[model samples]
Target: MRIRNSVIVITGAASGVGRATALHFARHRVSLVLASRRVEALEALVAECQALGSRAIAVPTDTSEYDDVRQLASRAVQEYGRIDIWVNNAAVSFFSPFLAVPMADFRRVIDVNVMGYVHGARVALERMQDQGAGVVVNVASIVGAVPQPYTSAYSVSKAAVRALGVSLGSELGLDRQKHIHVCTVLPPTIDTPFFQHAANYTGRRAVAMPPVYSPERVAKAILRLAERPRHELVVGRLGRSMVRQHRLMPGRMEKVMAHQVENTHLSKKQAADPSSGNLYAPSLDPATAQVTGGWKGRRRSARRTLAGAALLGVGVVVLADRLRTART
Candidate 1:
């Protein structure tokens, strides 16, 4: 798909990966239909994109609702005749034990992360079928493939999202709708506002897992996918490696992820009571949408990476020992 002069719709456009992606596409001079719950941030982004010499509109939307997503599609077509690309990037996260997480919080995470993508895909496919071509990019996560501890709701929702993309792609192929592409992006822990907005129950300050990539990197991959769509893409080096390692040694990889989750995903500093941050409502702070989540602990990523390497080393030694014993 030619990005220049194409019309694209992006959900969760107010901040983080979505915002970075929007700016990236804006550089290509594509018309943009931006949607997010934060009206003020959305409006500000609209102006920013417009200043970049692209036609853009901000539609304050809660993507968890089918109606809101449907309306977004209608508005995009109404303004730009057709949509060439649609990106499902709206999502929420919950960091808590599986049993400790409230049912309401869990349900809300599923609604936004899983159902939100479903609504976007359903509406985009309908319009694209009539138009005879379009691309749908779903932003899933490596956590979808490799679930982590204390993030049951978030991991499950992401896993479902990845499945949704695979199923949709298969169906589209079966229906001979090759021109309408469904691509899934499985990114590693990114430095985004997602941690700030995630509902936390660990009684510690929330932080993303280590080896965090800049949101711009994921945004760039998404832009590339919009140009040449693939069935699935893993964004970061660590994330891609994790997927391969998990495939080869599931139990060992699980232990590595659990170690990272326990040591990296939470701050040692004491935090306030558990609250569903931005799960039920939009974040009012414009700063929440910044590219970086402002998590600056001393060499956190380096330390975590070293810890992961140590775990891998131990696993290899244990395996070698087991093999020697079996041979003897």
Candidate 2:
């Protein structure tokens, strides 16, 4: 669809991929509805979009609340007269072993990551059904397909998000609502403030795993989805490879991921005390809310990771052969 003069609603527009996506749509001269709990951040982003020659509004929304999400949709329609595209991008992460994670924290993660998307999709669909067409873009992570240790809740929630899109799309097809499209995006570890805002109970600093890509990449994928909806779009090379490898060799991939999470996803440096982050409430100070995570993640190449894993397997077989020969 032509983005110029299109109406787009983006949740979690305060920072990270949502912020970048909002700016990207703004550049296309779309009418934008920006939602997040941080009113200050949302206001600033609205101004930025306006400066780019787009009509934009700031809606302080808590996605976990169904009412708030409904109001967001209502407000957008009230101002723009219709909803064209809805991007369900608000989410929270929890870092801890599944058994060690608090029940409340796990539930909160589900509330935001999974149910939040559900609410947005429902509201958008209602308006779209009335209008006879619309697109819904869901931002799920690679973890949705390949689970990561110490963040079981987050992984499960993202997986549910992906399933939500697929199931919803099928239901729409059954009704012959072909004009309504559901697209899911699976992004790699991104350079965002996600780590800083995550609920951490691991007693270690959290960081995006290697091969982190800029949020702009994911934002670009979202824009493409708006134009032409696809079933699922994987954002980065590393994320795509990981998904393929896990499907091919689940057992070996599990070992590799376990090592990667324990070593690369956490920092050995002393970490600050654990907190609930924004899971229960907004934790980002409005004054400091920004897009980048300021995390200079490890500079490991995606090719190197694949090559190293292959070399390790070869070396293991050769060493076993040498040991057997020596024993003989």
lDDT of each: 0.87, 0.87
Candidate 1 residue 172 Cα shift, in angstroms, is: 1.1
Error of 2 at 275 (Å): 1.0
What TM-score, computed on C-alpha atoms, does each candidate reach?
0.94, 0.91
The residue-by-residue lDDT of candidate 1 on 140-250, one tens digit each, is 999999999988888898899889998999999999997899999998877788888888787888887677777888999999999999999998656777887788778
Report the lDDT of model 2 for residue 52: 98
Per-residue accuracy of model 2 over 1-328 as CA lDDT, tens digit each: 6789999999999998999999999998889999999888999999999999999999999999999999999999999999999999999988997887899999999999998999999999999999999999999998899888999989999999999999999999999998899999999888888888998899898887766778888999999999998889999766777777777666666777788889778988868477788887776575336777875433446644764465356446656876899999
What is the TM-score of candidate 2? 0.91
